[model samples]
Target: MTATQPAAEAPETAGETFDSLNPATDEVVGTYPVHTREEVEAAVERAREAARWWASLGFDGRAERLRRWKGVLTRRLAQLCTVVRDETGKPVADAQLESVLGIEHIAWAGKHARKVLGKQRRASGLLMANQAATVEYQPLGVVGVIGPWNYPVFTPLGSITYALAAGNAVVFKPSEYTPGVGKWLVEAFEQVVPEAPVLQLITGFGETGAALTKAGVDKIAFTGSTATGKKIMAAAAETLTPVVIEAGGKDPVLVDADADLDAAADATVWGAFSNSGQTCVGVERVYVHERVHDEFVAKVVEKSKDVRGGSDAAAQYGPMTMPSQLAVVRRHITDALARGGKALIGGVDAVGDRFAQPTVLVDVPEDSEAVREETFGPTVTIAKVRDMDEAVDKANATRYGLGSTVFSKRRGVELAQRLRTGMTAINAPLSFTGIASLPFGGVGDSGFGRIHGPEGLREFARSKAIARQRYTAPIALTTFTRKEKTDALVAKLITVLHGKR
Candidate 1:
């Protein structure tokens, strides 16, 4: 596709072809380019050359280019939003919001990359006082990013912006369902740096993602379901390439009895059904203090009924981006209901072809797969806990720890910190993505290696420490001249510093 054209289809150079079908209606939304191994290798080779030039620009020059790119996005905001809407089957407002967030991230990354990645002087130990030690971050040549269908813009930009600001060229393989969004981003970058393909796009299915992992890129950044993330890590291992996986999450939100029922209800509704519940950090489970459990559930049910999904203007959201996700969502809702669970809002039939209506299940057993696994649909399982301690225990029981939230007046921060996840927001859902300074990632099965903030900058660059002796010392142990006393002194210092009291 040309820069002037809407990225309705992936470029022909990528070779294979696939279709993006609307989940609401089983119609072909558009066709996408399927990249092969050969094309991926070529793209990586081109990115390597682009990386050198981009790196040579230094931090300041790159920041300027990034700023210009941001301006381009800001100017053509409408056009970009249209592509996102077309490719992902989301509402135009949702598309605009996603793009706006991506622009913010790019701006933040560009403005802060130098401060986060530049050289810094470090302290030399007393024994090595003569040595001047400094540490600097260097780029990792090229990065291959495999993005997911949900939150295509925000999710991929988390990696893309950081990698670009850190001086590495990126070859992004957006989810087949949202290639247009990916293409739009790359085209906008060309407005500021048109000399080379510093940021390129490749679209295909799992095979293409596999090709990218094995295509000799320095690192891989992937965002998808946990099962798929595991497969990606396994593939990356074959080449010994480092990877950052933003896998799926069964994120839970807890509400204490003292919390405001109205606020908790509002948060739960938006958190569970936003984007048709396709978010990686979307709230999939809820544990309310028994004191307010009944009130919270009724309020949430009432609020959810007002939230609708369709291809209309007043609808809160649009259809699901992918068709296959419908089956998974259905299976989970069914399993929960079959295990003596009750649906306060939607039941098994909520899974529609193009959109899964908001589903809030209660009385689901903890051991049920619906409770333990990730259900990346517009669904949630609400349960009551006797107190905060039980809520904490249940929240931390999951293997996946990505993000969590707490709605408590007195113990918000303390409770948030206790959760075994990379990030938690007090009385907010997915706020960490907005604060560009805080590290955003997951742990255990949720995946690792931050993609935003300082942690993100360091993730794309390697540390290079340099220590030089400013002057020769009197005790030159390495020279082997009169070193007996020096060796004894070194032994004594080690014993004094390291020995048990």
Candidate 2:
């Protein structure tokens, strides 16, 4: 769950192209065309036509094609991982993990689309018992998807795969930094869906994304910073297009007094530093019970010592995928130090040009930028609270409520229910994202709407409700020939049936 707007760069004109570079080595990974508005509109038009044909294939027909696409992705998983590592500078294993999750989503969406979206009878109340009611989710024509660079495959596919399974054609504009990965995915999809341009790709920076939002697509699914998400929503409002925005987060981890200190420390280390702390739902702040705060901090510091970032296989994590993000990490560390926070491990110097070493800070002020803002780096702040109540209060104080973790031997679920977040993991880190059946999203500044599971399949569809008259009412209340006594009878019936309640 990581997404952000592209870094500042020179504007592009029509027919222009840009190169994606390896973040760690600064080598050209791939060059892609900067799709202009005209191009984007053309793609949307194509998708509009494709959507008809795609939807013509009923659930079984679409599911069969989706399975074929899934097989292609499975067979070429290694190749896709290489492209992911090359563009994003993540370790191969990390890329593989992301790709596997994406594949799992494709499989789940295809298999469950019928059961989740098929037409079904709906209950008719006593007043409407004479009518037969039913509802079904129908495709919403062409969908526009603006993806993020971090977790490029998984994050975008969260929308793309589900949209396809829901019977809507898609026009995907992947982040400029990871356009190659997007292109690879689109081409692979073409292998199985060659009859039409069901899933098209457009590449560029913000301009291209803006065009996509205005391309007359039925809906837009955007994954990025809250600021960018706001911009997307504003643009979509011009056409009254519905949107699903999966944005940033300032996730927290709460440790109870009876928690397993070792397990909590290990989860913190991995949750904070993995992917160089670029995860949207990753652990950014920790609130531990006063009884175990000191011990937990010490264990986190000891465990994070070996977690270093580099481009090598031996490195625990990779370099910052976006070079501009390094300055943000450095600023957060500097602010924490300037505010009298103590670094138990790496300090300001840990944030190098590309790779940011894991840094653990204690005694950081809750009002400070490091604790309040979304650092999106490999850094975390540990603060002690008087009890679980205080911990929950502090954890829910942030404006961004995306994901969180709770470590407790006895009150795991009890405490997890108290945090005001979209999802929470008990005794684990990011467990919700791994489950294909769970809905993933957030509220407030973390953005709105969800992707994944039945909700995700419905996200790309429009509900169609139907009601048919089954029989004439014995009271004859709706007929013009009804007598005045009929009204009196209905009034008496209403008094007897609902007046009491």
Candidate 3:
């Protein structure tokens, strides 16, 4: 994934800078400073002070500021989308969709933070009836956010919005490929919160991100490849700083025998080819029941015929955001063909210099690189399964379990629940990502912790438990004055309450 790799490196000398280019034409979009470790530490220190004031605003006050920020994003939506497209080489419409989704998340986080993290009463249990137990999620002060280039606006804000809502100041380190987008976002936030730098932007290569992990931030929220996520975890471990890693995913799509073949085919094509298959949750593999495998493949190939990658107005998608990924896509296609896979649509020739035409493969071995690795390109491998059971098994075989999709009217939810992934979309492509209330993360190699919904807000917070003594108990078990009879009475109570179960 490009998230884990540095798009470009700057010189180590002071005052060095780098340029962000449009992958389509190699045109310089913008130039940004290569923030050094010293600069990163300085930003963290500034965030520390800002965090105090930001948290003091309380949920309601902070929410108001966020609302204003949301308005800025909405009003300037087209501008940000242009910046996104210029840097990422994605279509303007795709960039707009990404920005709109990011705005929705900001609104949701701001509106619901109080209800999710504010102090709330907790059950005290029978033995502690006289005490009032309460718990609240408190801010972790400052947070370091290492964002990815793909879906730069939406993916990074998944962490930034939630962290801010949880009352933490954020220092975002966007990918070097899309520093212009990052700068735009930070400037928008500054318009609303001019008093303090609640959200800051630091642009550079992987070293800047590494600096953030060790900068003494309370927690680090990273979105990238599992390989890079591991390196970040190791760096964060030096200071025992906590982290929430949203890593790479080789997501799958399952098409059942009784599924709506048309709908499944449409979803598979869009999920695999949209954003040129740069999405972390995009479908990379498909498992279809033998009964409908041929029909489904035909529909997918037919539907994919019109989908092309280019910079033209009619193009469905755009070129590869990172030039290096072009080789990986070609390698996967070449390896699949070598292992007896048949290309139903575009083949190795589809991978051009900047753009990769949508490619669909069949009869591919399950252990092939195209099936097992994170291709992260506009390519998908379709495999036949005897039944839905095999479909589920094959889908769950990958080390990366980030997301999955199912197309079965009757077993949509059933099969979705059985998949070893963090999220699933039933008869839809990337549906979980649009819902602000749903938590998004993955198990196993996809990385740990969450970055959306209430879980996301809590990820940047620490739970503070409080038990207030409202009145003295007749028999205080916690007190040194407790009698042996009290212990006997507690044992009897426990037996009566739980022994039956």
Q: How high is each candidate's TM-score? A: 0.95, 0.96, 0.96
Q: For candidate 1, lDDT tens digit of each residue in 7-30?
A: 222235635578776655557767
Order candidates by lDDT, high to low: 3, 2, 1
- Model 2 residue 128 CA deviation (Å) reads 2.0
Off by over 4 Å in 3: 1-14
lDDT of 2 at 64: 96
The lDDT of each candidate is 0.87, 0.92, 0.92
Off by over 4 Å in 2: 1-14, 479-482
Clash number by candidate, in order: 2, 0, 0
lDDT of 2 by residue, 416-441 (tens): 99888989999988999999999999
